[model samples]
Target: MKELDCLFVYPGAPAGKKNLLPIMPAGLLAMAAYLERNSVSAAIISLPSALDGEFDLPGIIRERRVKLVCIPAHWHRQAGGALRLAEQLKRAVPGVRIALGGYTASRFAAEILKEHPAVDFVVRGDGELPLLKLLGSLGTGGRSLGRVPNLAWRGKEGVTLNRTSYAAGSATLTGLGLAGLRFVLNRRLTPRRGICFEDGMFTYVQARGCADNCSACGGGRDAQRRMCGRRGVALKSPASVVRDFAELAAMGIKEIQLPLNPLPSDAYYIALLKLLMKKKLRPVLKIELCGLPSGKLLKWLGRALGPESKITIFAGSGSEKIRRLNRGRFYTNAGLMAALRLASRLGVKAWTAFTTGLPFETRRDFLATAALVRRMRREFKIGRSGVYVFSLEPGSPLFEDPEKYGVTLRRRTLKDFLAQRGKYDMGYSTACFTEREIVRNLKFLEKTAR
Candidate 1:
């Protein structure tokens, strides 16, 4: 076999620890496909999955003569593992270059490059173009590193950050190969939550950027603007989305998840559903709703996906006042109940998730969330529901300005985030609740929810 030009490594928890969630970012697969299309040999390896199988990482790198290794620090949870793996790789394969990317990495690119000597580069936001350019430069001895847009590299004096100018558009999204199943199928990769490997579930991203500015979200509209220079949502055409679905179905993907709600208008989803109906592609569809969906949209979704389809709603808080304070799309409990009722009537399974430790949530507010969960259980046949603690995300409004939201930051720097390795720490405490109180409330909510 020919030597790989670059290898993409998806980091998990630190050594001697198990990751709570072990799913790789879907964007990494798409970026790998893009590299392959551009005549760059690239493959993805989930580090934890490989380690679990006792796969020889150093031996494989040496055998393959891999030139570059890319790791994604997209989620803050992966920070510790990513840096640990990079150091291990640097020790094992001394000549190989390491690069990190994703939302978390982009936000702290300069800091990562300055502090982590093992990481040779950090590709900031929308890595397809910047990564391709970086690879080309590396092939030519990295003399042109300064020219790569949205990149931060370790220079002789210090870390050098290039221009933040590459936000992927609809055309780029449409042309690139989004599914890279060939590389992942052989590995012992774990399935995402509520999905089994036998189910053949895959997440398909139909757009770049976000329309909402949820305060706690790292991928909100404001975060995108600051990190990726994205001014608005960039969406793939409905026809293009239909083509991707057909391709996935042809490859035996039984379930497809549109993880982000279509932005700008409901027309995008409606058009896509119409095309899917026309093509007679009936894969189990999962749509994640940022806010409550209208009855008309729910009806269209049911008609398009039939009874097996599902929708996951992120209802941050049950109390409308706390939700409003959180600064996401404002929708009342009445609105959410109405949507749930409509979904139940249409035979569409709905999974609603609430957060227990929001910024302004007091004991009463949390109890309200717990009560709402109980209410949901009594009134509706929800597929699944849970209340999770809200972790402070990097690049979020709360993280950037903790005082504004009455939040006290526990993990502010990259090193601080790396310390939370095998734990589910909230990483911040609100004015109303300490970390202990938050955990206690979470336990109460968990028991009540069940």
Candidate 2:
């Protein structure tokens, strides 16, 4: 048995998405690395696998003997589960300090602190420095409570709050250091039945924050700066990102997923691809494009990753109208199809996401979207497609001003969300679609995909 100070927990949200296979806790991985870099011994736990009876977490906690447990609540979908996991851990290891961090947790810190007694601390913004300080001050009997920044703690004078920074400048990818992906490769993390790729795939990040303003997404540019205190999108060097991938390849992780924002510069992307081409990375890389790509970029991607390397595009919605409303202002269905057409020609796989009953979505538009999805699958010959029900996110423009978009926003209160069956689930709770319509569309999507 080893004595440890902290253990990071990845609270999985299986019910939120139709397919949770690709939902890796990449942020927790990065944060773990950050902690390790600060000379703290840490390990990440999976709440999903634990719930599914894959491992004995209570036993593991006793064996490891950690003083503090940090469960990251980045996605709102995973927040409730994360809180529940924290409560369970507290009960298992009595007196073990519990904390939560990441986007969702930061956005809703006040209410979470008021509600969850098991959560001793909540990291409000940039987590690296604050977490490092918190760990250093742990076991000191409240001697250093005020020193830790961006922390909400259960103080003697009620919940004591500290200065929290929202700027990406305060905490950047470069500052957090390496992607601690290998930590998740443990057999304990594997479910009885998981995706085959889960056994080998590794997730990495190139940037923090996004510049686009997708109406329904809370991580949009405006939302980030206004609510999250994240200013500009902080990017890491291509050399740094490529170096990490190369290291992963050497470590026997051939399939690397770079879940980055659309790279800030095309030249940077070209350079990254060129560097990747030079390395001995036999990688099946998955990248989420912010928008449709140009022919040149597609050619660059083809040259960088040969036919052996599988590519998966994260394009959501094949309908132009839905794209404008939810995805971004610039990208169109035609542009997306063009990229897929190029991808098909280059022998690469792509994924186009779909949302039924969006704001201003007529039955005609839904039909058009369905038709386009079918066309992408059969005609353009893209790899795969997915469909989902549209629900307003807490931080998105659509959530703030539902009337403007012809959509009614539900789940405004923390109580509403906590009470919901699938709190952060992207179920059809929008004014645009009835619950029946959502269920029917879900069935239709399943049928089409089959």
Candidate 3:
């Protein structure tokens, strides 16, 4: 076999830890594709898939002669798994270079490099260009590491952070081949399936970065600015997105999820919907709405996507006051119910989600959320509805300025996050709610779910 220049590994949570689902981000595949397009040999392996008896990871690494390995600690949940994998790979392969990237990694780049000796570098932000430059330097013995933008590396002096100079734009995102799954080495493994795949659905990214600055979302606008130097949402062209959808449909993907609202303006979403309509590709479409869509937009969605298409509304809290505080875009329960009514009339199933442990939520506030969920179940074409306890995200507003939100941070550093390996842990607390209170409320709210 020929030598591989780079291999991207997606880490799952450590054993007994219930963090995120075992799926890798769609963007990671795009990064791999970007490297391949640039004449670099790259492939992806899901750590969960490897551990599921799909293949021997170390043997494959040896066979491919992979020179560099990249792992993403995109979610704080993956912190333990990513670092553990890096350390294990170091012991198993002896000489392979390891790098970590993504939101969580970028936020704690210095700490990771300072503590984890196995991680040779942390590609802090928008990784494509930085990773390309890092690989180039590595091929020449890593003497030019300082020139790589958006990178953190240990030097003779100490840890060095290069300028975060590369923020990907629409053109860059359009060319990434985001739906390219052929590069995943263990794509066939069933036990390691992502949440979407488990539900017989696949996710397609139409944009990078988010416009909203939701208090709990690490991928929100301010978080993007802080982590990736991204100024605004970078959308894939409508034509590009339509083409990717067609490709996914061709690959027998029966349902596709556009994970977020994909917005800077609704015109962008409308244009993509029109393009998909023109293509007449009728894969079951699912979208997450950061805010309630207009009735016209709902009607258009019904026309464009046909039946079995769905939309999820993230009503973070049921109490209008609490919801307004936590969300960037505010909508009243009356407005949400109206939107749900419109969606149901248009034959589009709507799913609503709520979080129980937001900053100012009280027991009464949680009951309001529960009441909303019960009302949604009884009065709407709700495909699913549930309330979950919130986990603090590393780059979110609440995480960055906990004092401002009246939140007390529990896991503030890389080591602090990595210590929760054996069980589920919510990462923060508020004056009104203890972690125990949060869990109790979550259970109570869930009982109201259908």
Q: Model-by-model lDDT, in order?
A: 0.80, 0.67, 0.81
Backbone clashes, each candidate: 0, 2, 0
Candidate 2's C-alpha runs over 4 A off are 11-24, 47-65, 166-172, 175-200, 260-265, 308-317, 381-384, 390-392, 422-428, 445-450
Ranking by lDDT: 3, 1, 2
Best by TM-score: 3
Model 3 regions lying over 4 Å from their true place: 16-19, 50-54, 187-198, 262-264, 381-384, 421-424
Misplaced by over 4 Å in model 1 are 51-55, 183-200, 262-264, 381-384, 421-423
Candidate 3 overall Cα lDDT vs. reference? 0.81
- Per-residue CA lDDT of model 3 for 1-450, tens digit only, reads 888889988877875666465667776777888888889889888766564577676887899888889998887888788898899999999898999998899999999999999999998778888888999999899989999999999999999988888887889889875534767777563342652253566766778888888888889999888888888878889899888878777766767777777463567767878888888877788888888787877877888986888888888999999988898888899999998888888888788888888988877888888888888877754435866776777889999999888988898887887775433378788879888778888888788885
Provide the TM-score for each candidate, comma-separated.
0.92, 0.84, 0.94
lDDT of 2 at 75: 62
Could you tell me how far off, in angstroms, the CA of residue 398 lies in candidate 2 after the best superposition? 2.2
Tens-place lDDT digits, model 1, residues 1-450: 578878887767777776764667777777877888888888887755454565566877889888788988888887777888999999988988999988888999999988889999998888888888998998899999999999899888889889889888888777775545565523444444311232345777778888888779888888988977777887878888888878777766768878767373667777888888899987798888887777777888888886778888888888899999885677899889888888888877888888877888887888789889999988864425787876778999889888888989999998888777444576888899888888888888888778
